[model samples]
Each structure stands twice: as structure tokens, then as C-alpha cells.
Target: MHNDPSNENGILHSWQQNAEAWTNTVRDGLIESRRLVTDRAIVDAVLDGQPRSVLDLGCGEGWLVRALATRGIQAVGVDAVPALIARASERGGEFQVASYEDIAAGRLPLRVDALVCNFALLGKESAERLVASLPSLLSEDGRFVVQTVHPLVACGEQAYVDGWRQEGWTGFGTAFPSPAPWYFRTLASWVGLFAETGWHLCEMREPLHPETGRPASVIFILQRH
Candidate 1:
């Protein structure tokens, strides 16, 4: 298995390659973690803030965007993968294809009440750039919400620290040829990054799987300091 996990562009390339299978898996609700817990965890997190408008930073296939729209909130989506953006657009709401570099460069010029990244922060440089630029992308009091794989649980046999980590999707499905690797950060690292980026962690929630009762994902609710 080839995981170009360390390179930022290589990570996007991997997502592009797996876009179809990923879309299928997401739409068909094949991923057990998402189906049972994390999906609702993200949606409810955003709704709890009661933001009039939301920007889903790495929204794939637009499920979260559509879900928010049903509650009468305007939702927009941006993603690097063309296929993923197309799939999201077809489903509904405003969906755009823009790389994190473009967005970080101030190309995305809409400030909303809330900015969200649902499992979208993947690469080291890319994630850093986007988070650092978030203040400009959000309204004066806009909040930022993020959902990611729980660092401790995801650390597996590796040392519990910050680095690039790769995981195969064999448990999810056999259709994926090359799974995209994600940058991993510890709990303290995450809070430090947010502070360094001019944001403070407001709330942290761990969404657990119903059956196993282990955390499926970790949510960080943040606000500009």
C-alpha cells in the first residue's frame, strides 16, 4: 500500500483517487463509526451553536451541509477534491472546489457565523495554514468547530505525539486502493495550536460508539480569543 501521507499534495492526490469509493461508502452509510456515532456528533455540535450560517471547510459529499440546511441555516462547503465537491454540489447547497492554499491565501472571501471542518484537517502545513487563517474566514464572533479521529485512540502502537499517521481502510471496505493519511496531534498539541492561531478551546466533547462505548471522535469547539 502506497500512502503519500507525509506530503501535503500527495494527501490530496490520495483523496482524489479514492473519491469515488469514498463517496459510495459515505452515501451508502458503509462506515460503521460514521453511521452509528460521528456523523450525528458533528451535525449536533454545529446546531448547538445556533449559527445563522456555517462554512464546512472540508465537507465531503456535502452531507453535513445538507443536514444543516434542513434546519433553516445557510450552509456552504469547500473541498480540494473535484469529485467530492461535485458530489456535494449535486446533493445541494453552495459547494466550491478550492485548495487549502487558495483559501489560506484569502481567496475565500465570505465570513460566516461559524466555520467547521468535518474530518478535513489532513496535512501538517495545510492544516496549520487553514487554522491560522480562520479568523479572517469567520465573522467577528464566529466560532470554529472541528471533528477528528481521537488522537489517543488513533495513536495505536505508535508513540503518542504529533506526526503523520496512516491507516488502511480495509475495515471500512476493499474498494479503497490508497487510503489518505492524516496528521496526528495530541490533546495538548491541539489546544496549543488553537491558541497559537488566536483561538481558544471552549468545549471538548468525545462522541462514543454506542456498542463499544469507546470514543469514535473528538470535537473541539473554539472561539477567537
Candidate 2:
């Protein structure tokens, strides 16, 4: 498999070593916390009983995949880390241990009605490669929905304290502490990425807190042309 120097051995090795504990912590936290608005919006948009097949990319621990399956959608989850895939499979979701680049090369066995990527695609080159592959992975008119750390937060241009708040979650608590090169762009950048990848941008939303009404995330929906 081709490897990018920025995302090579160290990052993967770190995740592999700590994957079990990391996945459990993440899973427990998400299960207890209230749903993020962006997550709800993504689910509302695509879980309309139409798209039977769905692929959850970078599906760590498969929470979203299981949620989709509970709604009767045929969902499969895939991630590069072996431990994460093992946990996902234990949850009754089909999980594959492979990167998006690997899957794009025909490593996976099935295509789907839609693709969902949730806070999973980071790093500039990797995101670009995955965005470039979405069109071919979907059925005609297939939809793609993604939730990511808002560009402002990820880029360090905007702080999480300014809007959405996570009290105890330290930014650098992950197994990998150093930041990888991330492409956290404004709306135009997102549109451009989809356009360059041959997918048409359909809708965009900046989800906000229900009470404070402060912007928390940006969600994008794209349709295969």
C-alpha cells in the first residue's frame, strides 16, 4: 500500500497499540453525550427508508453503522485500524480493516446507496484522495453525507471554547498528539473539493446548539453526478 510520509508508521502504530482502550473510551463518551446537531441532521437527511445500502467510512467502533442498521438500513463499516474493526464486528456490523485509499482500489466487496464519513477523514492528502473516490463508490444519484470537526476548530483558526464546549476532553489526549496536515476549509473549499471529485454539492448546513444557537459544525451533502 502507498503511504504518505506524514501519515505513516508512527500514527498507525500508535493507534494499533492503543486502539482497544481508545475505542472503548470514545464509544462510551458518545453513547452518554447528547447527539450533536450535525449527526442528527445527517441521519435525518439520508435515513429516509430509501437507501438500503450504506457505507460508513472511517467507522471507528461502528456506532454510526449500528445506528443505521437499527433503522433497517444495510450498513457496513470500515476503518484502517485492526482493533477498531474487531470491536465494530463484535457489535454486529460488517467491518473491514482498510484505508479509504485501499478500499478505492477494489479491496472492499460491496458498493452502496450512500456513503457517510463522520469526523474520520483528516489530513489533506488523505481527505483529497477519499473525496476523489466517492463518485465511483455510490450508485447513480447516490448521496454522500459527512460530519467533520468544523474547519475553524480543526484549523486552529477558531477555538472550541468559542461555541461548542467539551469540558474534560483534552485536544491532545489522543494516542497521536502531533497534528497531521488537515484541510479545514470554508464552504467554498468544500464545494471545490466535491466539484473536483465529480460530485455535485447539493446542500450545506452549519448546525447549531439548540439553546445557545451557536454554530457547532458544518455538514455537507453531495450527490454523484
Candidate 3:
């Protein structure tokens, strides 16, 4: 019951506070179901693109960076939370403490062959800005891939509409910091955002959970026109 929308830095502060726990959970394979299914789907699509390098935007603990590097693909990670960025740096990947806002302003300092965001696109405002900047961040044939909680699956009992909702953080433990504010956009809204932001939706996929046979997340592959 500690929700405070007035705190502009709430999301960043929460991640900063929960960085160690978050890193540990991810590295320990706490969400292994996602790592095995959703992550594999994304990595497969990324490799199919055959990019020389990639930008792992909002990369929490650098897992994707390391994964791509193992394939002989260079990847750089960027996160707003310094604590997370520090942890990612320790994992032997190039990382920077840059916010999505900085990336929107063309300050990434490097253009990548591809950009991937894994369950990291949070707020609608920030997401729109980042989408607007994708053209500049990617090479001509570069593709942008995003894997996130499916609106249908994540909405649960809540109304399937565009708005902010709190993440459960169940796997991270109750001791974890404030739940991050996630913007819920319907499937149509997601498609609309891509169209309005100048991206062509090349393909879409739904990664299903092995046991439940329900979508674990939605993946979108987009490109600039």
C-alpha cells in the first residue's frame, strides 16, 4: 500500500534498491521457464537476423549480452539503474548507465546492427520515445526485437486497457523493493504504437509455457521503413 505516483523517480529507485536481489534471481535461473522458452525464442529470432552487433536496451543483469556474445556477436547493454548497470558490467559485458531518454536523444554513442529489449519496456511514455529513436540506433538492415508480458496473460482479472499496473514480483520475494509500474497496452495498442512510431511490424510470435501451454510472452520483430 505504499504506492506513490507523485514520486517521479519511483521506478528507478525501486530497481536501484532491488538490483542485487534482481540480479541474483535472474542469474540463478529463478525465472527459468522464461529463460528456456521466451528467451530462446528471442535469441533465435536475433540470430536469424545475423547481426554483427546488438544493443541490449534496459538489460538488467546482462544475461542477453552474454548470450549473444557466446554466439560471436558483440552486444552492449544499457540501463538507467546504476546498480543494475554495475552488476552487468561485472559480468564482462560492455555496459553504460544511460536512460532510455538519453537513447531517445541519440546519445547512445554507438549504432548497433540490432536492438533487443527483453521484458524491459515499462512505461508508455518512455517506450514511445525509445521507439521514435530506433531508426537512428539501428543499422539499415537491423531489426528490433522486443519480448514482453503478453497483454492477455498479464491483464489477468484486470481490465484489458491501456494504463499502469504494478508487477507482482512474486519470484523476487516480498522483501524486494516496490513493484515496478508497468504500462498495460492491449494487443491493438501495441500494434498502433509501432505503426505510429514509424516501425513496420515484420513479424510477431507468442512463446508458450511448456507446462501450461499458455503464452508466456509476446515477441515483436520490427524494422524501420
Query: Ten residues in a row with the worst lDDT in model 1?
Result: 1-10
lDDT (0 to 1) per candidate? 0.88, 0.68, 0.85
Candidate 2 residue-wise lDDT, 79-131, digit = tens: 88888898888868777888867876766767799898887765456677778
lDDT of 1 by residue, 1-225 (tens): 223434676788899988888889999999899999999999999988999999999888989989999999999999989999998888778999988898999998898999999888878878988899989888887889999989888888888978876657877855897867778889889888888988989999999999999999999999998
Give candidate 3's error at residue 154 in angstroms. Answer: 0.4
- Whichever of 2 and 3 has more TM-score, that candidate is 3
Scanning candidate 2 in windows of ten residues, the lowest lDDT window is 159-168
lDDT of 3 by residue, 144-196 (tens): 99888889988899788888777758865335766766678899999999999
Each candidate: RMSD to true structure?
2.0, 5.2, 2.2
Candidate 3 Cα outliers beyond 4 Å, as residue runs: 1-8
After superposing candidate 1 on the true structure, give the runs of residues whose Cα lies further than 4 Å from its correct spot.
1-6
Q: Pick the TM-score winner.
A: 1
Better of 1 and 3 by TM-score: 1
TM-scores for all predictions: 0.95, 0.80, 0.94
* Better lDDT candidate (2, 3): 3
